[model samples]
Target: MPTRPLTCTQCQPKLLAYVHNQLADSDRRRVARHLNDCPVCYAAYLAQREVAQELAGTIPSIGLPDSLQLNRMWLAIQSDMNRPRTIPRPQLARMGVACLVFVLALLLPWSLDKQQVALAVPPPPRAPVVTASLNVTASPESGRRALPPTAAASSTEAVIPAAKTPDTPSNVQDTR
Candidate 1:
């Protein structure tokens, strides 16, 4: 009598063993029959076989050296591990620079306060001075009469009155 065909779940676990020829003859035959009839199981079996073949072919077998040489190498490594490590000069210099920067960063704000106090003296009092000098001469070609110096000065002062009384509006008129 023909046995019932194996499902993909049953076939999956045996694929690696099937590829490696490690499955029992009866199980191998059953798995082979299932793979032939089932496309999913066949594809899975092919993938597993490909991966196994690739891994077996790509990996190199490592052989150990004699125990005497292995022991010597291990002792040498142990000695190196046990030895104290000293910081190199360049590494110490870098650490010193980093510490100096940290100290300066901590003290910078405090140092700034002292300099700010020294610079906080009030400026000297002086009379307000007008930088612009207004000349009231008329253009000779235009032949227009110019205002007297006193009237021009009063008009100019009116244009820019003192800042003490801000509410007072200047009565300057545009003469152009």
Candidate 2:
């Protein structure tokens, strides 16, 4: 199991100063020994030093500002940092239009018409013929011509022949 290191809140302010290289040699030595034994303090010291170095680089390196100039600089830095960055509405609208045009470029060919369907003359209707006789047979023994299966259904008729036994001779005998 791992153990948590003791954090000295009182030491943090001096640690910050020490990390920034603004502390005396005696205080630096004390903080260094404390950091060697305490992993939390060591990490905090390293992080604070890195932040101090980054902040020092970001701000101008001029001499300390007098009261009024310092106030104005702090105010300006705060206001500028706090203000939300925005893409203007007109620019967003223009980008939307550009995207629409690009999509249309890809889709225009599919939507446009090149081939037109010509109008064709309709064929004349066929004349109906009359049948004077109707006859149907039901028994397989009947020699009447067999109608196709698609013929209109009648309660007494069947178009298909009955199943034959396996041993029965076929109608056409093979000569081969």
**Which prediction has the highest lDDT against the true structure?**
1
Clash pairs for candidate 1: none
| Per-model TM against the reference | 0.35, 0.30
lDDT of 2 by residue, 15-117 (tens): 7788767878767776777789878777888898888788878874556568898899999999999999885789889999999999999998667532211
Candidate whose TM-score is highest? 1
| TM-score attained by model 1 | 0.35
lDDT of 1 by residue, 99-149 (tens): 999999999876765334433444333445445555666677878776665
Return the number of clashes found in candidate 2. Answer: 0
Worst 10 residues of 1 by lDDT: 153-162
List runs of model 2 lying over 4 Å from the truth. Answer: 1-7, 62-176
RMSD of 1: 17.2
